[model samples]
Target: MENASPPSILIVGLDRYGMRACVRLGLEITVVCGGRSWDDGQVAVSPEVRVLLVDDHTNPEAVLMALDRAGLTDRAFDAVYTTDENALVMVGILARHLGLPAVPPEVAVRFRDKAVQKREIRAAGLPTAGVRVVDDVHDVTGITELGFERAVLKPIAGAATRRTSVVTSVAELRACSAAYRAEGTAQRTFVLEEFINGEEWFADGVLFDGELLFCSLSRYGDPCLTAVDTARPLHYRLFDPVTEAWAYDRALPLVTAALEALGHRDGTFHMELFHDPATGALTFGECGARRGGGLTQELVHTKFNVDLAECAILVALGRRPQLDIKLRPEAVGGSHLLAGPGLLYDCPSATDVLALPGVEFVRMEWPVGGRTPQGGGTAQRVGQFMVVADSGERLQERFTAVWDWFDARVKVVPDGLKTRELRELQHVLRPEARFGDALWQ
Candidate 1:
């Protein structure tokens, strides 16, 4: 075993974090990716790693052709995996092709395909909101059949809430869908789901062999569908197991059950659920069969000493994480300052942000002369920072102070509304989160 070559993997798409994990594990990595992902994520591949550039990593045919060209069809891969959400189905197919250790291709599609996921969850008798597929995202003539006054519309397999929106009226939906089509999203499949009003929270952890290895819960500041398009900074905080037992008691079962329903095993999971304080019910939003996005790895590591990226790779290679989490007494949280539209300037420096109380890390892309797209999603961030505190109360206070610390220094032009607030107000001002095209930036 000492002289054995490191476990080899065939990756469908190259993610910066995934690549880093592969290096740490000393795996022989072969990645099939499209051209734009290289520059988009600023991913740097080492010479030791094999890179196979294809026209589309998400396309099974293109990936197969790339493999055939590289003469890797018969290659004995230890596993087939992908951290990129877009290429998950393709990875599943490749996993089955190589008879590698990973979820079946059909099960893998459940993580990305909302319709199939919801159906499976429903069949499992889990509480899920009603969903109807919109064969054409641009047309919603049969909206009445959905039997809901308000609904959430998003791509079938989309991530980061790109082009996701809320529709309350037919006119508004038509206009929004028209806008989506006009922006070249006509070919994408979308779905409409009955909107569940409640405080939205998410759980992330590793599950192995149908057993929950570890779990962490966190509550979101606003309905992501509405907050992501506004000036409010999207934020959330991890619930301390000792301090916030209520969240753990309610969320743990749901996360595990839902992951099981989707047939997910031996991997890190990111599941979003809605907690109805009024009714004491949890509704499934969605789940991803990978590590949570953003600085989650850092946040989890800072508080619990768990490396989710490392765990993800280990699980893919059919190995146990054997996770030993040394939970710190302190709590961890993160805030993302998002833009609306127009130009952004005078963003705060990481050094200045680091000076703030409890601030542990900062990652921002908002430069002085950068421009933001119209429909600003999660990706449209001025930047984000992580904070740690001894308790949840102190964490909340620091979360607010971080906002005030940044707002005073940053400035935006053309429309000050784009990124001016730099703080969360929806929770305080509007207890009930509502979404419509009017709120869409």
Candidate 2:
């Protein structure tokens, strides 16, 4: 048979660092974007990357159809990289069907579905926060009977904290259920768990046939999902790895246990965990077999010289990636999602900020006249700024200066506001915690 066209990597999402990582790896890439930025064919990037404009409303089957039309599904590509936690299963199944490896399709659902993952992790005697899945609104009452002070209500298989809520009272729990029902969501899977209040950390690592190849811990002063306000255009400083430990001793064991329990034989593992400072309690939150969102992969690369997207691609292609994790002391990196009024306005001095010593990238999502809705998804970003510094404190200083500068520079000119009340509610509900200040000046 004639030799197939040069091996290509098909990346299914265009959110954060995945596309860049694939490109940096020098892999022939075809990016399938379901968002307008990808659909309008105005994505400003290298020409080597082929863009497949797909609609946001396109179903999973439709995505596969697009791939087939591109002749990619006919064994033209060597591997596929898919983001979006909930799409893990479908992407894996599709990739496998096309005769390619996809980070072990058997455990794809475990990453997105909390109930299934919790059960399997518990079965393996791994330390995991307690979870109760509710099939109906009435299940909230039973969940309350478990005697937990607070319960986290989240969709079983979803991302970006779409319906994730922390309920302290039975009323709030019932309200969460009502809200879910009001949306008419067919899959009413809800995970009610004991809230783990502590220092939050994220562990992203690669696994080769059940063996850990690389792992690093990302420390957060607050729970990541709770750190942002969806009621307003919100932005926050990214976590710096300077204070974080490269050797996640506690996490290493827990990860191994979780993987063994979930039967995840291959692929990258993105895990969120909580460590109680008072008691040194370590608990598993969730794990995904795919790359994480929030531009985390890029943060890791800039801080530690590790590329998770590249790792995912290499694993998918069955090629062992080089392992040279260069650790640097006092090195820091982070990104800020610029959120504000739904409508975009004149953004200030981004060029000047980009010129800063440690600054790496400045990306604005919405155009000067684009509308930015109050949201927690990737679309909510008005802009994003990334920077690196000598320490976490320096990083935060630069981040805050630039953020305040951006906020002052940008304002919605015409006000037909939609999320005004929601913004006020968030200020009331949101607590004041100094994120990224632990290692600050």
Candidate 3:
């Protein structure tokens, strides 16, 4: 349907990359966002585009009313899509009502609920940890009967590993459950799964029309649950196809099957998994129904020369994406620079990080004085950056060099800062700054 006016698509949530990619693809777009989400300015939405805010984007009637209010109710829409998990079901609902191209609502629900997602994986004869769901508002002691010595605990919806934990005893389970309940928030439901002793890895893929088009696997520096609390920064290195061909051969099938098991026919998927170092077996962890967050799609480009953002928009518009994994010339890796379980007082500028050799990209996650909470889990970060190298050894060195460089300038106060330090910690938190020194470092 090539025409003077671009084919319009309705996005149910804010996704910066998807919006820009749509512009690149020459598509007309309308966006509907929940009032809280729209106002949060997370997307930093542009006023030039058509956007509608409603009390609830999940309510198709409200969305229609917003469209009516904006005089866009009768506009031709080619697809309904969203990168926000909270909006997937809404997008699916709108897609079904409008007969537009998108993943089915049932499939969307499967991704939203971890219990259903794991059940679907198990049903497909895939290996995933055995899980039991318990409400945080009740006595979670009953899960002890499952007889698993070690278990994993997380919100039923996988809330970015905010409170995810590995429990070795019932006491720990009760403590985590109590913490979640005490929060008095929507994440009162939790899942307990048998913990698998294996290396954690991430799988990113683009699937369209039930056919897998592109997939990439990367090895995490440590188990996700453990790394959130450690001072060590979380890192991941992409599997080089030349030396790690087995990773592709093994994980590609699992990713494809997992998507198929959940009836996720179209769009991109970001999945977590565990791989046994000894046996090479894979355990499905969790999957998200959109592109991986935080430069993942861009990292995909650095490793494979493929743009997942463009592919997602292509399928969203009911168009074919030229999906191909073209090998790059060097090793690629990414890191989330950890700053605190306390106050993050300072960090080097983006330019400071980019000045380091082999640093391809960097973004400071926290501004000066943005505090990271005690036990913030994986959400703790000062920034994220990517680096490239001609060899794997060089890549490791680059990562080490970046960390070493940051250690010199970045500042965090594990113990509460003094009144003056709270006012300014660059002097106190710096590496060379001394407690009783007469001059500031």
> Among these predicted structures, which one has the highest TM-score?
3
lDDT of 2 by residue, 339-372 (tens): 4555555565557668766678765555666765
Candidate 1 lDDT over 1-441, as tens digits, reads 779887888877876667788888889999998877765554567786899998888898898899899998888888887777777777777777778877777887899889899999999999988887888876666665445788888888888887778888777778777787788764468888888899988988987788888888888877887677566777888888887888899988888889889999878888999999987899998998888887788888887888887888888887888878788888788988554465665567888888888999987755667785455567767778999888877888998898887776565554554333423432332447853336536
Q: Please, what is the TM-score per model? A: 0.87, 0.81, 0.89
Residue 3, candidate 3: Cα error in Å is 6.4
lDDT of 2 at 113: 77
> Model 1 clash pairs?
none
Worst 10 residues of 1 by lDDT: 420-429
User: How high is the CA lDDT of each candidate model?
Assistant: 0.80, 0.67, 0.79
Off by over 4 Å in 1: 1-3, 46-48, 142-146, 343-346, 366-370, 411-441
How many clashing residue pairs are found in candidate 1?
0
State each model's C-alpha RMSD to the native.
8.6, 8.9, 3.6
